[model samples]
Target: MNFAVETPWVLAGLLFMLWPLFDDGVRHSPYPWLDILPSDAFSTGLTVLLRILGMATIAALVLGLAGLHRTEQSIEHIGHGANIVLLLDRSNSMDNTFAGKTPDSEEESKAAAARRLLTEFVAGRPHDMLGIAEYSTSPLFVLPLTENKEAIQAAINATVVPALAYTNISKGLAMAMSFFDDRELTGSRIVLLVSDGAAAIDPDSELQLRQWFKQQQIRLYWIFLRTANSPGIYELPTDSRNDNADAMPERYLHKFFTSLNIPYQAYEAESPDAMHKAIADIDRLEHLPRHYRERIPRQDLSALCYQWAVGLMLVLLALKLCEVRR
Candidate 1:
């Protein structure tokens, strides 16, 4: 408890209350000889008691006027979970449903399905520290790692817009990696990347990304949304020519992630149901100890002081009413 007032000097006026102990206020009474009687001893003690109560009431009122309160403290909470980052791709191809992005279609678009399922995923995990990032031509950090489910769901909802830009996977990965900086090495930290297409990464950039992931000891999961005509990561080219390798981008991207020697998994989702299954699998795979802190705001003590003052004043009022006319 502490005072928050600008002028605490008013507290000095409380000393004046002690003056009642040394002298009674009565000046010239007609029956001055009655003060020397032995029977008046009880009345003398009562006067002292009433004076002390009055002083206490005045002191409480002064303290209340000074504005007393305590400092805010943080409440630390621990649980079992992981730090997961949702890396979503906003390429134009993702705007379509798993069947196709055709006009006047009744099926939900891939982006819409993702938004709905991710919102559900966030709602289920009360302990996990989750973050969101969306990438098109560049990466955008939608939210930082936090236990705030509402904010995370809002970021996922905002990603449902049309995807007119091209996918930049390398930059997206780089942006996701930057989030773990200065974060404590606790629990199971992982990145859940969701995308429908893949792009090539330069050899220099690939080496740096691999080394960085190894240093951080982070896990990666790619929830690949397979379209109707796109080649899957496991499918091999029918052509014998060596140049056919370039046509299978997903395979090379999967190879690069595996070469990092870190924990990694890839799931191919062909429909909305498959997408939900993939997220559930990721949920089961990533589980560990999670530590977080929440702030508890300060509370004021002025109200309690005022209550004490009011109670003491009521007692003094009762004492005065019972006093005799002498």
Candidate 2:
């Protein structure tokens, strides 16, 4: 609730003003406001004053009102986000390189690229609440919605090589929704889906997911890594799945995004420069808005004038009854 107190105390001003006018003219002994009237009159005034003050107190509490003020838009508080969730894909395809990494050891999977991009996103948005999930044969909860970016990054790093064995897009969505249920969600809830698109989810399931996301008002983002044309596919690990060890699962993934109304883009290059561009693009989507957050502008409180109204009333009413107060 917005509030303001007048710079010059109204109570003090009212007391001084009433002093010369009423204090000198009145000298009807102690408890004189009551003395000026019959016993019944004093009782009625006291009762009326108490009743009015009681009503004011009740109004303030019920409305969360900072007294009453005319409606004015103040930009003091902007982009104070309520909540958001990052639904990242962690299937075996994530382990496949879109743009080739060092191409040695367990270091350069598509998942790694996505994580690096996520780090950039996290670095820029310190205020955003985020969570994570790794989906393949099924999606696994890596972290809950938290402000601890370091903890979220650590969990992402710990995810090891996964089999492009199976894809559970539905389960991942369900898990993400469950995270919101565990906490209180208020403003723009979002899900940034970073996928290599290997899973072949059913049409019905995909439509259901889309409807659910729309109803829940969760904004979906698609960062589809172009694995079909990348350099590292031949080197991809395939126990018996590929003759050439081509680990990229291209068809199902493309079909998944194209079917959804979600806006999507791809990282076409197979090098660091291309990967950086993809990261930059995503950063703009999430971070640019944050960067422009300052544009919301701040407001100098004007409602403070009304608070003085309350104080002034109290003071004048006091002076009018000062003799009786004693």
Candidate 3:
């Protein structure tokens, strides 16, 4: 808890507090035959207490004017969660429902469903450092990995816009992988891909992606949002001739991910409920104890200072009212 002041110049007013100590703020009167009167220790103690309260009130007012506050800080602790990056597909197909039609009043689009479920997933995992990236023709980096829940939720909610041209997942995966660059390896790293379709990656890009996954030890999870009559990640072609990358891109993509020799899982979701279940499974699987840093935002202390000043002023006012005059 680092304390700071926004307006240092206002602290100069603390010098006024010395006035109470020097004079005690009391009117002096002459009394004859002072030697005959015994000293009253109770009156002396009350006067001293009143002087201290006066100085405290002045100090509190000055501190309030100075805008005292605590600086933002980061704290590290052990937690049971992973550092996950969500790689969402923004291709045109995601704008349609699971039945391959524009969403109507009774149904929601795949993108909308992903956004809703992802938001809930983020809320549930309070300790995870989550990031978000979207891919269509190219990868769009929405946010970096951090424990800021509001920013993560906002990034996920922003993905419901109209779809882009195509899905270049290789580029998206690369972008997502780059998020862990220069980051502390304190826990499990995961790249979660949510898409309705897949695009074939070139031979050179596949080699680079494989090396990245191996070197970083990152886990990959794919949530394939299957539309009507669409091929699933495990579905094989009838003829061996159609078994190539171009024919069954989703299946081949899944195969490529598995070939990376890293932890990988794929889920085929035909409806919103299936997507929810997939997210739930992910939430359950990534619960490993690891160290993570959490940020605490800056806080203002001026209100507390003013409250102290007001309370002291009331006490002084009561003392003044109770005083008797000759």
Candidate 4:
């Protein structure tokens, strides 16, 4: 534990401690009768002890005036949580209700529901390191992996419906994967993709996606916000009849993600309740024991020194009050 002071000159007051050695400060009384008592040595020792205490009291006061303090170093905090990257879709389609139309009732739009639920998710994971990225025509890394809950929620809330005419899921996933690069992170690594529409990726991007997930050992999840009358992941696209029709973009994308040799799950959310359940399931599955670091800043110690000085002075006062009348 290191100590520092605001005013070093105040320490000169400690020189008074040497005064006791020169004089001993014991007065000689002229009464010859009392001088013969064997109390001389005892009186000398008591005077020395009192002078030392007096110097200590003064030192404490001087240190308090000098503003003493100690610095706090960084510390490690352990917890059970994951490093989660929220891959959000900001395509214009998300601005509609699940019924596939602009929201007319008090019902929330798909984007609004996602933002609200994700805000709740971020708040609950205090120890987790989280990042967020949004995509429409391309990807935008909104916030880097961190434990700052406020910034994460603010990024989520700030997302506006994309003006682009496409959903670039490939670029979005690639950006999410980039968050884990060079990071010495442990615990469950995840990429939680939330989208209401789908678009196919190029063959090269798909190969890169597989390699990234496998190399980083990241789990993948897609929360498909299903609009009414749209083809679900398991169903044939509207344009085709056969099961092998890679016709529907979502179905093919789902197939591709599942084919990767890594933990993956896709949820089809047709309503707000289903959306909540999907997020809750992800929350339940991602927790695992891990260690994280926390930095605590330096704190002032002047008040503590003042407290000690007051306590010592109180002791001295009590001793003086009980002293003999002479």
In terms of TM-score, the best-performing candidate is: 3
lDDT of 2 by residue, 1-326 (tens): 44343333333333333333332333445543555655697755755655555444333332223333333433322353434567777665566665433345645776666667677767776666678876777778888776666787787667655545766777777677667663443555677666655444566867777776656656555555665444331234345454221243444444454556654444443544566776676556653222111122234343453454466457546756765533
Alpha-carbon lDDT, every model:
0.82, 0.56, 0.93, 0.84
Please give, for residues 259-306, the per-residue lDDT of candidate 1 as tens digits.
Answer: 888999999999989999999988776767778775456778778879
User: Which ranges in model 1 have alpha carbons more than 4 Å from their true place?
Assistant: 1-72, 103-105, 242-246, 295-326
Clashes of each: 0, 5, 1, 0
Cα RMSDs of all predictions?
5.9, 12.8, 2.5, 6.1
Residue 54, candidate 3: how far off, in angstroms?
A: 2.1
Return the candidate ranking by lDDT, descending. Answer: 3, 4, 1, 2
Return the lDDT, model 2, position 125: 68
Candidate 2 backbone collisions, by pair:
4-304, 94-111, 99-270, 136-166, 197-253
Q: How would you encode candidate 4's per-residue C-alpha lDDT over 1-326 as one tens digit per residue? A: 66888888987877866664665434545664865667787766777776776677777888888888877656677898999999989888898899988876688889889988998888888989899998888898799987777778888888754445678888999999999999886888999999998887788988898999999999999999999988898885444464442457888888898899899999999998899999999999888987777655577888888888898788777766756654
Number of the top lDDT candidate: 3
How many backbone overlaps does candidate 2 show?
A: 5
Off by over 4 Å in 2: 1-83, 99-102, 105-107, 161-164, 182-185, 228-269, 287-326
In candidate 4, residue 160 scores what lDDT?
54
